[model samples]
Target: MDVDARLRELGLELPEPMTPAGNYLPAKAAGDLLYLSGMGPIRPDGTLVAGKVGDGGLDLDTAREAARLTGLQMLAAMRAELGDLDRVRSVVKLFGMVNCRPGFTRTPAVIDGCSDLLVAVLGDRGRGARSAVGMAELPFDIAVEIEAVVQVAP
Candidate 1:
């Protein structure tokens, strides 16, 4: 199955790439590898949903949803660069940061929001190792942040 159909199977819709907030580039490619910048859950409407998981404002489920949104944004950035998700060879690595209370123990679980979404969208090619961390804070105070390193076709 193709990328779009796969997304439909998972009931996901990828939005257009959101404009970069500042000077940073959306994504960069080196050799066969593409390094996607950390993407936050800034909806196209420009409103920001900012909070931390396990924190007072953002709870675990909301944080997980934010991570999933980040994954969607990551695909948007990739499509902006590579034209099609078919260029992706493999999702090599994913780095996730979740804002949480001091003793939050579900960091990895939260990041599964991204991981599971990627696989749902990209199929087996999206499966990859990942690291999820609890961060003190993040830009825009978003609930979660995610970056990815992926191999693309020649």
Candidate 2:
């Protein structure tokens, strides 16, 4: 599929890939797989979607949107590393972490925000093995953070 065209059809634009804050690279490649560093819900303007989710905090819908935004950040990193989205053959896995109040058990539902967007943009190739878990805190206190692995065309 034409990934760029698909993004246009969905009216989505990838933000600039976030720069690494420390010494780690944003993405690294090994063989045919690309590994993306953890990405957060950073907007195009460089602000982050920061907050906790669940009771007395951000609601599920807001957290879900943050997850989607985090997905876009990952895509931005992938494009920066691969030079094109089409280089992606398939999404391999995703490790998603949601910053939530204690007792929140909807981590998977929140992460479905990113998973759903990926399937929409890349069809079946976007579906991947995934794990979603809650965290008491994350870097920048962002609402969501995700890391991905994808198979790519060399």
Candidate 3:
């Protein structure tokens, strides 16, 4: 299916590309690969969903949602970088980091939120290798952060 149709079917709207908080570019392309910087769970309104997962303030489901949102944000960045979502050939890899309370071991499940959304939007092209790990803390104390590598059409 076309990307737009998929997005609409999923009831998802891509937000405006987020501005980089640091000096690095949000995304960069090299040959067929587009690399995105790590992005946190900031909403469309520019507010962060900040907290540690498995903590009282953020639960697994919420962190999972945050991962999904982070995926969308990365897609927004990709669109901004490539000028069109159709330029994407496939998702290549994803690295996810969760800021969580001590002893939280369900990082992979939380990161699935992102993986599932990508597949929903891009079908088989979204399937890719991934790594999900917990961190003692993340920038802004956001519940989850993720980065991606995508292979784009020439």
Candidate 4:
């Protein structure tokens, strides 16, 4: 099944590509791989998610949800670029960053937000190696940010 069909089955819909707020490209094609830049938890309405892990009144659960939303936004950007999600062969790498208090201890859980979504959306093929780390803050005060390395059909 293709991505459109899967979206139908999953009762999900892709959002419009999130407009880059700066000069950088949203995604870059490197041979058969697409490297997406770290992006915020952007909503379909074109606004970034607003919260900070263990800060700004956001707890771990809220932080994780933001990460999940970031993952979905990443997929939406990829789908727009490739025209189809099935073109994805393997998800090679994922990097997540969480904006949190100075000594928060939920990096792994925050990263799980993205990992779980990939498995749900692309099954085993979408699962990948990942790294999640905490930072003093993130761009736009986003609770989480995520980027992906996707192997695409030639």
Best by lDDT: 2
Better model by lDDT: candidate 1 vs candidate 3: 3
Worst 10-residue lDDT window for candidate 4 reads: 48-57
Each prediction's Cα lDDT score?
0.86, 0.93, 0.90, 0.82
Model 3 stretches with alpha carbons more than 4 Å out: none
- Each candidate structure's count of clashing pairs: 0, 0, 0, 0
- TM-scores, in order shown? 0.93, 0.97, 0.96, 0.92
Residue range with the least summed lDDT across 10 consecutive positions in model 2: 39-48
The residue pairs that clash in candidate 4, if any, are: none
Considering lDDT, where higher is better, how would the candidates rank from best to worst? 2, 3, 1, 4
Q: What are the runs in model 1 whose C-alpha is more than 4 Å off? A: none
Residues 1-154, candidate 1, lDDT per residue (tens digit)?
4887777777777888878879989999999999999888866575566876774667778778788888989998998999988899899999999877788889998899889888888888999989999998998788888999999997
Clashing pairs in 2: none
Report the lDDT tens digits of candidate 3 across residue range 4-110.
Answer: 87788888999887788889999999999999999977777878888988857689898898998898998889889988888889999999999988989999999
Evaluated at residue 102, the lDDT of candidate 3 is: 90
Score candidate 1 by lDDT.
0.86
Ordered from best to worst TM-score, the candidate numbers read 2, 3, 1, 4
Which candidate, 3 or 4, would have the higher TM-score against the true structure?
3
Please give, for residues 1-154, the per-residue lDDT of candidate 2 as tens digits: 9999999999999988888978999999999999999989976677899999999999999999999998898888999999999989999999999999999999999999999999998899999999999999999899999999999998
Q: In angstroms, give how far residue 40 of model 1 lies from its true place.
A: 0.5
Cα RMSDs of all predictions?
Answer: 1.5, 0.8, 1.1, 1.5
